[model samples]
Target chain A: MALQPFTVHRGVAAPLLRINVDTDAIIPSREMKRVSKQGLAAGLFAIWRYTEPGGREPDLNFVLNKPQYRNASILLSGANFGCGSSREHAVWALNEFGIRAIIAPSFGRIFYHNCTRNGILPIELEAAVVHYLAEAIQAAPQQNKLLVDLPNQQVSVAELKFSFTIEATPKRMLVEGLDPIAMTLEMTEQINAFELQHRQRMPWL
Target chain B: MAKTLFEKLWQSHLVEQLDGDAALIYIDRILLHERTGSIALKSLAAADRQVRNPDEVFCVIDHIVDTLPGRGDETMMPSGKEFIQTTRSAAQSAGIHLFDIDHPKQGIVHVVSPEQGIVQPGSTLVCPDSHTCSQGALAALAWGIGSSEAEHALATKTLRINKPQSMRINFEGQLGTGVTAKDMILYLIAQYSAAGSAGTVIEFAGEAVRNLSIEGRLTLCNMAVEFSAFTGLIAADKKTIDYLGGRPYAPSGENWKQAVRYWQSLHSDAGAVFDREITIDCAAIEPMITWGNSPEHSCPITGTVPKIDSANKKSASMQRAQDYMGVKPGQKLAGLPIDGAFIGSCTNSRISDLRTAAEILRGRTVAANVRAICVPGSTPVKHQAEAEGLDKIFIQAGFEWRESGCSMCFYAGGESFGFQQRVATTTNRNFESRQGPQTRSHLASPATVAASALAGQLTDPRTTQKS
Candidate 1:
């Protein structure tokens, strides 16, 4: 699939539940070697599987196994959403698992960049708002929905409203499928003109 | 306006200004590792362009190869095999020096470069790996680049870069006993949070930095990426010259005298200015650990999990950290049960790191439930450790003695941790799922890792003694 210009997905908000839920927890390490994203959706949370090689372990405690959250798309997480190494694969894995946006108190700097580069909307909300989302998601499990308005840069779920800030350059790039290198290349006409002029003056080209 | 160290270096390297903040900077050296080099080489091949300066580019195979059980063998995995083959071929075809698997010099790119003296003062270096800043301990300006950028650098020997503002971090007072440079950097990260040094080159100065050995300086610069800095550098000094004196690539005889004079002139002017300045009291630092998933979510080992209430006035990031780490407000950090321990990586895998771990584990055995492994940074480091009987001590203490390479750091190739395994490691980051899926890693110094491994819990090194 060709990369699409990122569009804000607006819908009823999904309630948040966990803190510090990492990319690895979203998709385990053993399942990361598929060479591509296909077939990875099934292994989203392989550590939660109840069946084992020997027999059923019956006591597996997987977040995805909970009755209410079989297909939650919006993840409400604690501070530093992506906190480990700078693996863009983590964002790819999360995006493949159907997480369209992540509302966190804060995010790892590199992970945040990776998310933006891959079109995963990471929203930074206040602590109270994150707690409220978690509580709302857990309490009413059935009717919880969050609204993410990208143009307006606001997140509204239940009675809470949160605002986020993204700088203009990265924001435009994420929404328009532009990277720094690509933007640099786009100015090649001017660069070439300057180079030609310089070579004429210095005879170095 | 006074110039910062970055400004001094950037101006000195400027071939010409390209427009606005961008410049066509002269590059002194470019380094490549397995993970990113293959794609870079393929791109160059696709472009039908040859490397502009082969003598300035160095390639090392470190990321994907397994380093357990002494040496790694060629495997069936396409990525691993391709990484090895592509790096070897690219080096051979380009006439670049190649460090292949099990070569006595084979190790983490950052570690090996400095130890072999390929990285020198007053030079600008780039690598495909983020921790390349580890080489900045030699007073070189080293930074990481993506594959595409690497390809461009390989072909042109120049990088179109936007000059970054500079930050000066001064460390005064003596570091407390058992508190390594790793602790000082971790403490800074926690205080500044992750984005504190974004878009800036950081220079380490003051008495504490002057007192650090080359290996310790490497540890300090190695974690600059954790703060999102462009790079971290120290001024070239006697310690740096001493470390490089006998290495393979150092200049000999009169050439050495000229080189030393040039290096001495690389320091910032006394009145040089910086965009930002932060001073840290080294005496105030303690052995640190990351209780939460991020490197910035660290605290002194004796500290408690930060309470949500305390973070009430802070960024939403604090609350998120509280939630993600699953710690209730005011929870103590010591004595947390650990499932694994790792004491190796480019950050803390020098001979000093191994010796520190050996000192801690000299007479004590690892706890029955702890799965611990100690990987040296390079083959020479391993050989040196064996010569000093450090490997026997590590093995006798029940820690797995592994070969050199970036084992358990990148989670590359086939090595990884079990789900939900809590690991005390000497690597730089402890982000969520960093070691493996659902595996939680806590960043610490090598001594702290050894102490934790012996106790099978998050115990302070100060409390654990061989006696």
Candidate 2:
């Protein structure tokens, strides 16, 4: 399925400074009541977002629940964000909750790939840079807006501008909303040829 | 040219080299569980795509399936029935192999794949579950993926992957008594941070790895995800060939001979160099246990938690974990009272793991105050254990001998320990609320969990073994 294209996004950047922010924390398994990816925004950060498991009452202490950051479209976090679990629901929930981009020092490999597939830009920056951005965003939660330019591979907030690195395919997928399956299916001839030889070489497989 | 085992596997599976560092890799097998399988299948159909090679795809009713006796579609997790039913119907419609709830072959995706010989050396397997890396024990290039990636693989039988750098971890010397593959992996994660092996695939090698059983190798590779590595694998040896000898899906007769010949060559050349290398002295490893949320926050079972240095950047998270776990900075993990003990999951639910735990549980009873549960990894493993009277030993020890599946390895809104309960468990991952609401899970070997349960406290398995 093709995802929504992301060209440039400028919005509120919520700083969740904890390291190793895993997918389970983003959307706990209990919150995944249904198989479908829809209706997960309520469960985004369910454990920390709510007063109790499955409760609607918000925990005012969480960064996302703060009135100033309630509409956060970008998440700024420490290293290894989206670590643990290959559950795509975490990315789906974040996307549903208006999270278009996540800036972190590093990410769980599987989670990083999931981000581009869902049109969520995962920006990897140096730890110091991510800390700087978080401190700057926290300074003026409401007024300070972060800008993410996908085409140019850059992220900026006020005078702070940093260029990030992204692979070509994922970069194109996020920018053009390309359906990866469709593109791969286009190479049917190559896949068939490879499989034919592979089968002959190892018929047991 | 001397090539690493990983490089050989990568080159053999490479369908095409795309722009950048990515390549189109052919997938030999795809494994799935009900947790995310239904979504992948449903989305594939919704997108008007068909499974390119249905026969190559296999689905099992593992995650979220009840481990209680005579369990059906109904589950403790609300609406879990829909997931099971949907996956069953979708898998059937797609013409893929389905291990339904009643299927004797049903088990955790990682456990079932290897047991059935569906995973083989030099093949590339992809699954939607993170623990899929466990199959790397068979020397297969396998890793976890998301549901969307699952759909893509089902539709194209290929994945656009950026090849990760390769690393080799050599575990030299012999392991101490009661020290196990689980301890080796835990010690590695604790020594290096959780993100230590990020952006790399590690080949666990050396004499210690060679001496471990296939199940032990699986346990060692299972938590490679915990270390944040792309995956971990070991070179195929005679032991691996012997393990796959008569597996249901493995080739037989003439094809088997050909397969063995190929698998024998699945090893890194002597002169092959890795992007990075680390050597751990197996003798130095102790029965390791996690004290905080992340698997990295671990120590020797007999050691005390280190006092947090407030000046450290990650001290805040450490403090949070300490508070959540209700443990003092310098509290000793050994003899720490636990509310529960569990031995299951892809990590330690196999027959060999059960035998080791049962050895500790023989003629011993669980503490009256602790709740202990043991779920075998698969029906075959469970049946084998039963034939060996391991179930009776576990039941006699006061541990609930339940059905096979990924039961309480994770909370998942179904089964969970009580609020703020402490547990010594064999499953991987000790993240906060992983086993229950604010539940504190200390990961260790099955022997450790069994010994700890028998003592009603975190007792070292080595101590109990000595007795």
Candidate 3:
């Protein structure tokens, strides 16, 4: 896919769904077998849906079971979001699930990087704001909307406007569609210049 | 300002300052495994580049190989098989030492590296697997990198790094009976939350750390990634030297003496400072198990789940965990049903781990409802376990004895649990869907896993042991 800077949808609200959302929870571990990112979306929540043969023992208690959350694009979660293994599959699963942004008080360090690298925006907000959004979603259970402006670092739901935070480096990379690899490769000219100087000095190249 | 251990190491590794907040750091060694290494090697080939120092690079086929099935079988997906083949070819073509499938020393990359003494004190190590930090247990500075970064490291023997702050975690008091390093780390993660060590290199110290065995130290450092720490380390000492003594790559005789002298000096100075400090009373910790999807959502095996309402009310993430884990407030974890139990992984599949499990299962049969398995970490570990009849004990106790490799953990390639099946596992990470999609994994030590397998639930090993 060609790299493109796409604007995030503004004022698109969804109910707060899924709890203890770990990286693995987003995608099943079995799906990690594939080296490349393909056919992952089909099994995004496979464990929740089909662990037992003939699907005799479906876990209705899982968040993915609730039909209302079938297409929610924005996920408002509890503290320490995406904790556990640093599988980037969690980010891929969330992207496949159509979740463009995650609003939480904090995130596991590795998960945050995976999200930013895959064009998923992880917004760190105050606990009060997260609680407010979660409570509002629960109360309405139907009409919860959120307005997220990445450029302004603000998330607005109902009458409350909560500012979010992102480190300058990750923010720049996310906004510029630059992953770590892309960022490093962007310095090709400098690297090439250094290599040329070294070759001339040592005759090794 | 006082310099933290991280600062000292970063300063020592700096080849030059590249720009603001970035530096060109010399990497002493790089380790690679089948899964991520294949991609990195492919990228290098695409760029028409060769490794700068093939001797310094090591390759091991672990993640994708089947631990239950014999070697050469294609149990993994087609792509996984392809990755393994590519890694084998790339290692040979690049003149890098390759530990192919079923090699006596082949096993979890992290476990094999330290066992073989490829990981030495004061060196900078990088791998594409997140658990690469496990090598930090040897007092080597190590961290996980992305495929692209791995490729770069291979080509230049250097990596562009941004230094991290340092945190010193000190534990006092003797650990109570039945508590292992796994319990200690679980307690730390639960108390500090998963983000507790963010942007920091954690240096474990104090009496408890000092008393742990080298293998125990490895278990403690292996899960540093669970807490989001950049890395975790314990300074090398006599115990470290003892463990490295006759390993394959360890220096010999005069060189060994010189190396020991240098390793002994790697400890933090008496007045050395850290960016943050946290202390724990090791005696207070009990055998712990994760109640929810995240490792941070853990509590003592005897304790009840935290009330959802009592969770950080401000943190939606905690509240969500309370809801998704299907755990109710005031509910004890003692009698929770488990569908499976696993004992073995890079984290706890060493000879000591097997001996502990075998001792616990000597006369008991696994619970009728619990399907259990014990996988050795490497071929050598398996051979040792069999020689001591540990595998026979496990099989007699209703546990499947499997070959050596990264099995069931990280879904590298092994049988997965049924959806929502509660599993008491000795491997690291209990994240949502970690064992399989929607499968609930509870992290514990090998002894605890054996005990739970017998009880068919989350049970403490201390209660079941006949001292």
Candidate 4:
């Protein structure tokens, strides 16, 4: 299934400034009762977002629970965000919770890939730049909405504008919402050719 | 012009070098578990897609399957039964090999793959679990993938991947007494934070890595994801060849000879270059354990919790981890009381790991207050341990000897440690609430966990061995 193309997204950004914010924290295993990706929004950050385990009561101290950030469509975080686990449910939850993009200094390799495949833009900026944008968003979140321009590869909030870089393939995929499998299937000849030689070279495989 | 082992493997498996570093890589094998595999298979079927090559795909009922003796499809994880049933039907319909719950070969995907000889040198394998990198110890190119990517690999037998830069981590000297592969990796991550190898493929080399047993090498590479690396690899040697010999899926007779000859050439050239290189003196490493929620929060057993400096950028996270663990700065980890000791997971649950722990539990029983459980990585490993009377040692030592699977590696609304329980565990990942709600996990080697269980505290294995 093709994703919703994300060309330009402007939304309220919530700050979750903590380094090594791993995926397990993004969505706990207990919250994943089903095998599908839908319905994970309630489980996003459940450990911190909820007052108790498997409870619906919100933890008022949690940033996402705050009124200003309740409908947060963007997340601003520290380095190595989504650092552990290869579960794409982390990305699925963020996408379901209306998160269009995430700004961080760095990300877990697999989670970064998962973001692109899920129609969520993961922008890597300097820690200082991310902190600056986060501060700007936190001061007056309603007025200081973040505008993510995928075509230009720039993030703008308030008077600050920062340019980011993304790979050509992922950029095209995000902008076009192209199904990667269908695209790869177009090159069936090349894959078949490689497999034929691979089988002959190492019949054991 | 020398080429690194990564470059050799990359080129060999490269279906097409796309724009920039992006390439279409052929996937030789796809391993799956019930927890995440069900979603991928269900999604693929929903999209009306068929598996390109079912012969190369293998599925196992590891994750979410209860590890209790005489276990069936019912799991402690709610609705976990659906995942198993979905994967069972999907795998059977797709005509792929399915190692069901009662299959003698059933085990964690990573453990079962290598033990079954499904992973081989120069092959590229992908799984939906992060510990898939464990198989790279055999000189294979394996890495973790998301469920969608699993579906893509299932439908096309290929994936669009951006080639990662290469890095080589060299453990130069021999490991000291009580120091094992688990300690070496923990020490490495502690020295250079968890994101030390971000965006790079690490080839663990040097004397220490080569000296490690195949199981030890697997333990070392298993935590590559925790290091934030794309994957980890080690050159195949005589040890790797001998370990794979006579395995069910390995090449036989003439094919075995050809495979061996080719695998011998899977190492990096003498003067090959890497984007980055780091060397560690293995002799300096001691039995290491984590004090906080991250793998990077590790220290030697004799070390103290680090003081939080307001000026340090990581102080906030450090403080949060400390507060959650209920430990203060300057507090020593040794002799700290523990509520539980668990020995299982893809990280360290093989026969060798079990034997290492059994040596410590031979005569001594677990502390009267501590709850200790040992889950074998695979049924075969469990049988081997029983054959050697290692299970008797574990049982006699007051530890629960359970069935084979990924039990309690992470909580999934299943049987979990009590609230606020602090555990000494051999599994990877010390993330918040990983074991249970508000549970504190101290990651360490099987020896260290065994020692902690015996003493009911965080005791160094070396000290226990002396006594």
Off by over 4 Å in 3: A1-20, A38-77, A92-103, A116-121, A130-165, A171-205, B1-3, B47-50, B76-80, B93-95, B253-255, B310-331, B335-337, B410-414
Q: What share of the true interface contacts does each candidate keep?
A: 0.04, 0.75, 0.25, 0.80
TM accuracy, model 1: 0.77
Q: Model 2, clash count?
A: 0
Q: TM-score of chain A for candidate 2?
A: 0.97
What are the per-model C-alpha RMSD values against the true structure? 6.0, 0.9, 4.9, 0.9
Q: Least lDDT summed over 10 consecutive residues: which range in candidate 4 chain A?
A: A134-143
Q: Provide the lowest-lDDT 10-residue window in model 3 chain B.
A: B308-317
Clashes of each: 16, 0, 15, 0
Could you tell me how far off, in angstroms, the CA of residue B132 lies in candidate 2 after the best superposition? 0.8
iRMS, all models: 6.9, 1.0, 5.9, 1.0
lDDT of each: 0.74, 0.92, 0.75, 0.93
| Local lDDT at B331 for model 3 | 86
Tens-digit per-residue lDDT, B1-467, candidate 2: 99999999999999999977789999999998999888999999988899999999999999888999989999998889999999999999999999988898988888899999999999999999888889899999999999999998999999999989999999999999889999999999999899999869999999999999999999999999999999998999999999999999999999999999999999999999999999999989999999999999999998998799989888998999999888998899999999999999999999999999999999889999999999999988999999999999999999999889998888788889978999999999898888887888999999999999999999998889632
Q: What residue pairs clash in candidate 2, if any at all?
A: none
* DockQ score for candidate 4: 0.83
Worst lDDT 10-window in candidate 3 chain A: A196-205
